[model samples]
Target: MLDFHTLAEFSRANCVSICAFLVPANLLATVLTIILTALHRPLHQIWQAAGFASIFALIMVMHVYSWFAIGVVMLPTYILLWLAITCLLANLIAILWRRRFVNTPSLSNNA
Candidate 1:
């Protein structure tokens, strides 16, 4: 099992590869989930849970107590981030369609 420092060093050495791309992407997904939740979207609980899991992993890593293989840790992060972003986009599109076409009045409908 690698210590956090060792893992950090390894990640730094390969920063241009997967770690560099994923860390920012995960963080961005977390932020997007939080934003969507704040807006009272459909992904409230799922986003909260995924965000909590990521935060827990990040805290564990920061404290040097994380023991999972890097791939093990990263794979779930990627999956959850992708899921959250996809759900958020779908919810946004649904809301926009409802507001523009379903809820709002149109001249054609009046005619």
Candidate 2:
């Protein structure tokens, strides 16, 4: 397993290349999913929300890890990471709750 410091150094060294790949890839996939869902309205909503939550959580985790790797261990970073984790867990719970109990027909009719 690579340490945080090593990962940070690698990220700094290949910042441009990493951004070029990660940013565009994430954007493209999100756009494609949105487009597909818009076109196919009957697609399950839970799947979409779950996918989004998972992606968001992954991004937050990556950010926290990167901050640790970059030698910027400070109070603000700690707070931000704590918030991110909390939000991620909340979103995950929401997704699970909606999956288990929320009815799509009732929600659609209500809306």
In order, candidate lDDTs are 0.49, 0.56
How many pairs collide in each candidate, listed in order? 0, 0
Q: Give model 2's clash tally.
A: 0
lDDT of 2 at 20: 54
**lDDT by residue for model 2 over 1-100, one digit each (tens)?**
7696676667656746655554544444444444544444334664674476457546645765786765878785576466556545654554555454
Clashing pairs in 1: none
Superposition error at 58 for model 1 (Å):
2.9
lDDT per residue, candidate 1, 1-111, as tens digits?
Answer: 758677666654554574455456556655555455455555445445455545534533432222243434566545544554554454455444434544457598787
**Model 1 ranges with Cα > 4 A deviation:** 42-111
Winning candidate number (TM-score): 2
